[model samples]
Target: MRMVPMAEADLDAVLAVQAACYPPAMQEAADVVRARLRASPDTVLVARDADGICAYLFAYPSRLGKVTPLGSRFTLPDRPDTLYLHDLAVAPRSAGQGVARRLTDAILARAGGLRHSALVSVQDSRRFWESLGYAAAAGDGVALATYPAGALYMARRLSA
Candidate 1:
């Protein structure tokens, strides 16, 4: 399999893989995704085998949004050096083969050598991130602001 940076031409295939992997409510709008690629294509990572694109992750170095202040429930720390993992999806056919993990490692490695930590909005895979050393921020509920959909906030420090 090959892990590569996203390109404009990859959008249709990436969108297909994402739709195949997520529910409608969670699937990103194709236009929004295309815009993100136009602005920051390198932020998205994809996995492809001989057949085609199988799994992918959409991430960007993001800031703590208008959530509660630090130390509040679900409040993320106010730090700019954080990588925000927006989405991680593996094709149903490719699930359970460590595709997500591999994609994550590739993205993190590309984040350069200057970052405080990486964060992700987690929904069904709390255990998965915890296994990777992520945990609920000190703050819990009120601090998290649901985007288009509600998801829990978790973070992991990139070990230097």
Candidate 2:
């Protein structure tokens, strides 16, 4: 699969992939996802193979210890030090095809001078993020509470 910047046209497919990956309680509405895309278009991406978009990754610049509560709009910081990976979903059919890794790598490659990268690991995907060098980290308690049970806030320092 090839990685490309997420476009408005990809929203439908992105939503489909998201629905297929996450439970109803964990899913964010389309409007929330669209607003995030507009807020930081450069950090959102979609993976496409011959069939079509099979995965997506949404990220934004923010403080390392902060957590974006589910369904809330992203409030970008004036002096961001971390790239927060907000969401990542791969179509069930595309699982194990390296699509998620490809999208993650692409976003990290675009992180520029950020000092770290973080994400909220849900749906029991902690091992996947851990394999990518992330480790459980503290986050805003109130914000973290918005997630389902067992969700973890994870982060990793970036190499200069």
Top candidate on TM-score is: 2
Per-model TM values vs. the true structure: 0.79, 0.98
Candidate 1: which stretches are off by over 4 Å?
A: 64-79, 121-123, 138-150
74-155 in candidate 1: lDDT tens per residue? 2233455666676678888788889888998898886654354445454568788888777776423554443334466777
What is residue 5's positional error in candidate 2, in angstroms? 0.3
Question: Pairs clashing in candidate 1?
Answer: 73-140, 74-139, 74-140
Candidate 2 clashes between residue pairs 3 or more apart in a chain or in different chains = none
Per-candidate local distance difference test = 0.67, 0.93
Query: lDDT tens string, model 2, 91-123?
Result: 988898888888999999999899999999998
Give me candidate 2's TM-score against the actual structure.
0.98
The candidate that wins on lDDT is 2
